[model samples]
Target chain A: MITYDDEVVCAPRAGTLYDVLELILDRGMVIDVFVRVSLVGIEILKVDARIVVASVDTYLRFAEACNRLDLEHDVRSKTVPEMFGSPVAKTVGRAGARRTARSLTDKVRDVLAPEHEEAAEAEARTRERAERPRSRPAARPRGEDDRPRSRPRRRTETEDE
Target chain B: MTAPTTTAPESAPESAPESAAAPKALYVYGIAPAGIRTPRSRGVDGAPVRLLTEAGLCAAVSAAPPRLRPRRRDLLAHQAVLDELAEQGPVLPMRFAVLSPRTDTLLTQLRSDAAHLTQQLDGVRGCVELNVKGTVVPGHFADLVRRDDRLRTLALQTRRRPDYEANVRLGEAIALGVRREARRAAREVVDRLAPLAVRTVQGATDDEQVLSASFLLRSADEARFREAVAERARACGDRLALSVTGPLPCYSFVDPRPASPAGR
Candidate 1:
């Protein structure tokens, strides 16, 4: 006779993509012989994800939430439930903190969601090209060569070491 | 950045010329000993998955994807494949986007590395990885302000003055106090839980997330482990919010090599 609340509280939560991002990206076996493609924008994504944690904006939000506390109330009575009961205090605390948290979530969402509109447009262009097969040798070989050149010489140099 | 265009005609040639040239490389998910059933989960880019057996081990892989990105669906697909494999037996999961240059290289690597890989797999068999993360709850700031005279005085001064500068100072102090308490609780949680695990690996933590650790535990002990976590979560609920993820594949516990032959 397990209660629903017990099940809710005790069950292990399914991990989200954000939860396992470090594991998939940073951990696991990579043999020396394999070439790890330099993923574009990965550095930006990692930095952006952690940026909100220590920002001055976050500090100010904490202060604002603390300011809403009713200092005159008896300290023992000021439990988390009581704090939740005050709509004004709850709203103020959430409003200040939510902005930074929301922005971080949005950044993660943008990084993870495939760019469907852009993919569709690219597909249309490819379809058009396929329809006119004899127009030109595809400009792709040059692009592939350019991709390898764009990789910094320094990265390969370090791998040699 | 936008997704890389993967439709290049030149992309085909590089993967095409090798013997058995299938116009695709193998996107490896993990390596397990021969005889486990193939995973039903879709592979990255929605390719159907199959196992390639050599020596005594089999590598679970899909047709190499044309340009890999950290798209949400693909990441989940990678995890799903490993998760299904882990259910059957021990698996050595590859990092995301590890492509074997050719089928020969993959088969050769498997044959040569079979002993090392099998020993590593045996080490993690019947165990699971449990990742615990804790973030500051921020609800305890009221108690913090009440307990410390310095913080109390600062709050009183801010209330009296109520200027932007005063408020900022007050806020910074409260933020520091909250983070300090959360970190302390995080240490206590780890201390209590680490003994339950065979190995503990700490992950990066910041001002917001005070605890990020993965624990490897025997499957039989998972219930007791969860009970311990729930108890700790209750004990520190006001100051820290803790979440447990897994009974997952032992991502953190696997050794890069099972000790050098000469212990190098």
Candidate 2:
């Protein structure tokens, strides 16, 4: 069973920037005369968001979660809530983090969070100063429960695979 | 996993030439029917946005920021301008980062393609785009194991031997079964929700995200659509987690065909 907060996911909210990122970048009318800016970071962002590599780590995590399940008892009799202290959900949740795949989701959460742009902008500035390989956002360790429940919404079917 | 190297630093040099140009470039937000109020929202680069009118249509534009980057502030600003325009009537939101080299070029395109653009705008006039996405919920692993003989046998076998390789196989099978169930739930979601919208457009999907769809919904039907989505969320909460974001400018429904063949 999904958490009550997860159930609240159905409520419609105004589209955040990440929610409509694909629409803003990919869709919409473009007159031939207009210059579509060749955005540099955006290509990497799109590529990062889509590549869900089925790595050994993900398989191992899944196996660990499955090992905890009570296969002997019929699952139909007892719902998901009774299963191994939410291990499967936690595994599935962390599955998004496979091989830096979490960056997009982290970015999405960062964007969707109600906190203002100054924090994100400042973080971006610091990252620029560091000139480090794209590091994870500083915003990650905050209580995950505090994240405004927004679904991961991609707006195109095109694949790089 | 490399950090975004080209963040704010690269933007400064790029905008230098744009600022030096004779006729300043205009960053376009969107095109709407003539005479909506100039959007009060701060535009890209914090420039004030104004509408450029021609051919009975007005385009919301701002002096292109000398150094344009897809910064969070600017992207939100672009959407804000279009959202304001969309509130009043139909608007063809421009793709982000579309810059008119000069005001005249934009005016010329608007004049030449006004008829086709207007027709396209009319198609989405009373409608709004609501995007619904559903991700796989491995919360149902127990249920999946119960239902699938292969998964159940593997789970039992792995529990008995409990070795590294055996555990991996059992886990991979469960993951596969979870995705299969989620995909089926995702399909059921679209089937139930599609009938309520004027048009449905499917988006990308992978193992984790089973469904991403945009429904072109009439403004009035927005509530009903949400209701249907809520019901689906409850029914499939075990397998899929669904969320809706919109009443947005109809981005998907527009640009289905070239606005003007000659312009292409």
The candidate that wins on TM-score is 2
Candidate 1 C-alpha error for residue B41, in Å: 1.3
Range of the 10 consecutive residues with the lowest summed lDDT in candidate 1 chain B: B1-10
The superposed Cα distance between candidate 1 and the true structure at residue B126, in angstroms, equals 0.4
DockQ values per model: 0.13, 0.22
Global CA lDDT computed for model 1: 0.64
Cα displacement (angstroms), candidate 1, residue B179, comes to: 0.6
- CA-only RMSD, every prediction: 18.6, 12.9
lDDT of candidate 2 over A1-161, digit per residue (tens): 22222333433234555567777778887777777788878887666556553456556656765665556654223233223222223323322211124533543343224235446444544554364322122112223432323433433322222
Scanning candidate 2 chain A in windows of ten residues, the lowest lDDT window is A133-142
Cα shift from native, residue A147, model 2 (Å): 16
Cα lDDT tens digits, model 2, B1-264, are 222212232222233243423355778889999988889888887878889999999999887765778776777888888889899999888888888877666787888888988898899989999888777665566667767888888878888898888877876787788788889999999999999999999987887677889999998888788778767766666677676777788878888335453352
For model 2, what is the alpha-carbon lDDT of residue A80? Answer: 34
lDDT per residue (tens digit) for residues A69-106 in model 1: 55665332233312322221221222111112333354
Find the 10 residues in a row with the least total lDDT in model 1 chain A. A152-161
| Residue lDDT tens for model 1, B1-264 | 222223222123363365553544577888888999999988887878889999999999877667777676787889999989988878888888777655666777877777888888898898888888776666566778877889988988888888788877887888798799989999999999999998999998887678889998988887788778767765665566666777677878776433323121
